[model samples]
Every structure is written in C-alpha cells, then in structure tokens.
Target: MELTDLRKMRGKQIAVTNGLILTLLTIYFVMISVLDVTFSVLFLILGISILIQAILGFLKSDSTKSFIPIFEQVANYEKQKMGREWNKQRRMGFIWNLILSGLMFMQYYFSRGSTDHVFQIDFTFMFVITLIALGLINISLFLHIRKVDRSTSELDMKGYTWKSSLVAVVVGVVLAVASIAFIMFYILSNL
Candidate 1:
C-alpha cells in the first residue's frame, strides 16, 4: 500500500478501536452500577476486555502521532508554556486547598467548647472563608484559561469535526434523556 493509504487505514483502525473500547467501558460501568454487582470472577472479564482494548489502542496508535501527545503539543505551544503554567497553577490550587483545610480545622478546633456551632458559630468568618476559597478557585481557573488561550493563540486546534461533534452531542443528549425517562418509568412502575 502507498503511504497515504497506509495512513488512512491506520486512522480508520484507530477511530474504530477507540470507539469500541470506550463504548465497552461505558457499558461495563453502567451494567456494574445498574445491576449492583461487585468484585468477582466476572470482574476478570472486564479486566480481560480492557486488556484487549489496550492492545488494540496501542496497535492503532503506533504511528508518530497519538491523541494525548497531540493535545499536549497543541496546548503547550512553545516549549511547554501552558504546561508550566498549568503545573504552577495546580500547585497554587493545592496550596490554597491546604490553607482552606487548615483554616476550617482551626475554626472547628477553637470552637469545640462553644455552645453555638457550625451554622450558628461565627457566620461571618465561615462565610468569608468559604467565599475566599471559592473566589481563589475561580480566579485560578480563569487564569489557566487565559494562559491556555494565550499559548494557543495562533494554532486553531479544532478537536472535533463540526458535523461529527454535533452528531455526538445530540446523540449523547438523547441517550441521557432517554435513560432518565426509562429509569423514572421503572421506578414509577415499581412503586
């Protein structure tokens, strides 16, 4: 086969295998949850299924380009600008969470002897701390988005094709609504 044909074949293989593996995963989770099953020999079936899937994924993704690396390459822009910012922002978020945790702990620890607690205990302090934590999270998220946008300013990395994207979204919404309806019907009928 010509190089072009080989590339096309690989792309098709990748798409098909990717779709199948993900669908299997969705089915596995849904069945496990819906049937109220647990760890057993049946789980071995899930394991083997996933192993086969990984092999198929590796086979299809053997070419120079893979999904994650492509996405990273797009997002990182030059020499990991977005990546560095992401790591830095992630650490900042962790630190903020730790600070929040400590503050909450202190608030609880010091107020252990108080007659009024939680909802009635220092409402202003609780509200202020909660607001600050929320604001920090929002600010960090916005900053990350800004950094990513700045990095990928020039490159138009359209992750999905317009038609397929639309179709996928519509199908997902339909499935979700239908599943909810089915579940409600089942519950109501049982009642």
Candidate 2:
C-alpha cells in the first residue's frame, strides 16, 4: 500500500527471483559440465552481484510515502497517469523475461543435442547477458516506479478484467493445440 511497504516487498521479490535465476543457471551449467572452472567463476560473480543488489535494496527504505503533503489529494488523471506508467514498466519486464526464458529453453535444448556446439560462446554469452538483464529487471522497475509517484507507484489497478482473462485463456489454448498439431504433422510428414 505505502511505498515503504512496497519497497520491502519489491526487495524480497528481487532477491527471490534473482536467487532462483542464479540457481537455475547454475544447475544448467552443472548439468553441462560441473568442473568447468571458467563458467563456475562467472556464476560466482553473477551470484555476488545479485546478492549485493538485494542487500542494497533491502537497506534502502523510504520513510515517507508521499512527496506531496499528507492532506493533498492526487488528481484523478495523475493517478491514472501513474497507473499507466507502472503498468507499462510491468509489461516491459514481463515481455523481456518471457523472451529470455525462451532463449534459455532453446539453448538448453540445443546444448543437449548430439552435435558438438561450435557456436557455444556466441549463444552462451547472449544467454548470460539476457539472464543478467532479467535479474536486474526488478531494480529497473523499482526506479521507474519511484519516478512515477513515490507514494502510489507500487499500487496497481487491476489491468485484467474477468472477460479479458477468459479471452486470453482461450487464445492460449488454441495456439497451443495448433502448435502441437503442426509439430505432429511435420514429424508424420517427414516419416
């Protein structure tokens, strides 16, 4: 509700998400080759960066929620503008995270293939960069929120109504079935 509470919540979200990201990446690296010293060091650095960010975020707490006086009322349209700005940042984060996740899945799948990967450096570097970006996304979002309105930036108007949710579900299911059918068709046709 208040920015102070929101900051703490965001700090937790950042720490937890970044921790999980590191864990997943570490697991993948281990599965590929547990004893690779080069990658192990890189992972350690990434872990440290995430840890420091989390600590800084946790320590930096805002005491006051509103820059405006307590008695001042935020205009309705300014409230809408803040809502829109926060939502925009949220959407950006979600889109980028999804993109990075897809890239990671593709890398994981290909890395397990029989052929030796000649482009390992190129692909791995991209994945690592994207992973870092994903981990820092929360901090970027927090900055964006602070810019919008310290008091209410963390507050969200429900972007999705029930009707919109149902439509999204239907579209998702349709796309999934079509993708599966297409894959089956390709395999069967090749056979």
Candidate 3:
C-alpha cells in the first residue's frame, strides 16, 4: 500500500474504535436512566463491568501489537482531519459544561439558604472541590487539542518530544486521580 493509504487505514481504524466506544456509552447511559435499579446492585454491576472492560482493553491493545506507536500516527491523522468538526465539538463541550456548572452553582446557592441541613451538607465543600477538579479535566482536553494542533506531517516521531509526552502522561494521571477522587467523594457524601 502507498504511505498515504496506510495512514488513512490507521486513521479510520482509530475513528471506528472511538465511535464504537461512544455508541456503547450512549446506550449504557440510556439504559441506566430508564432502569430503576438499586444503588448497591448498580454499583456492583458497574464495578464488574469496568473490570471486564479493562481486561478487554488490555487484550485488544496486545492483539494490535503490529499497530505500534498508535499514539503518534493516529494523532497525526486525526489532527489533519480535525477541521470544522473539532471546532464544533469543542464549542459544544464548552457550552454544555458551562450550563452544567451554572446549574450546580445555583443548586449550591439555594441549598445554603434552605433550612435543610442534608442538602446543605451535600453541596458544601465537596461540591466546590468537584468543580475545581473539573478544571483539571478541561485542562487535559485543552492539552489534547493543543497537541493535535501541533501535529505535523512529518512522521517517525519527528514532531513529538520526550517533554511533551511526559507532560501528557502527567496530565492524564492527574485527570484520572481527580476523577477517582470525585467519585469517592460522592459516594462517601451520599452515605
């Protein structure tokens, strides 16, 4: 195959994988919202499903060993494709997050004025912490977009550097930790 054809195949592969995952998530969320399952049962099922998913993800990556350096090449192709669609996606994310955050702040403000201690306690310190952690998520997304924007036509690791890779790893870890902390905080607070 020509070099361009190879790159196009890889890019399409990555896009297909991402699309499938998003489709599954959408289906899962829709099902969960429609079901009236108890919290304990839901949590148990979610935990087990997540564990299975991690194992499957590992196996999939292992099986695709021939597709080495997925990060570098896949990113370059996606970046090239990230034209108006990416801009639209970014704008939608910003608008949705802004509206969600505004609703959260409104809830917190109203809770404080109410005499109900339960609601007030629920939305107090942890809520603020969650909001701050959300900034980390936004930062990670921005970092990804910046990296995509910096993608160059030259392949073979010509554009990416060790420092940038390290920064990406650090940001990813921070986002993961923040996400776990938020989940834990929510569980504990609700209990």
Best model number under lDDT: 3
Q: Rank by lDDT, highest first.
A: 3, 2, 1
Give the candidates in order of TM-score, highest first. Answer: 3, 2, 1
User: Please, what are the lDDT tens digits per residue for candidate 3 over residues 4-87?
Assistant: 775566556556655655566556555555665444444445555544544554454323223446544554455454544333
**Model 2: per-residue Cα lDDT over 1-191, one tens digit each:** 56675466545555665776677766765545534344334444445554454454334332213333321122232345455543443344344444444554455454444344222333555465556557456655455345444443434434422333465468658867975786577558757
For model 2, the run of ten residues with the poorest summed lDDT: 69-78
Cα displacement (Å) at residue 108, model 2: 11
TM-score list, all predictions: 0.28, 0.33, 0.36
Q: Mind giving the per-residue lDDT tens digits that candidate 1 earns over 22-93?
A: 566457545654564434323334444444544554454322234655333333332243334443333443
* Backbone clashes in model 3, listed as residue pairs: none
- Superior candidate under lDDT, 2 versus 3: 3
* Model 2 segments more than 4 A misplaced: 34-114, 118-139, 147-191
Task: Compare candidates 2 and 3 on TM-score and give the better one.
Answer: 3
Query: Which sections of candidate 3 miss by over 4 Å?
Result: 55-62, 65-169, 172-191
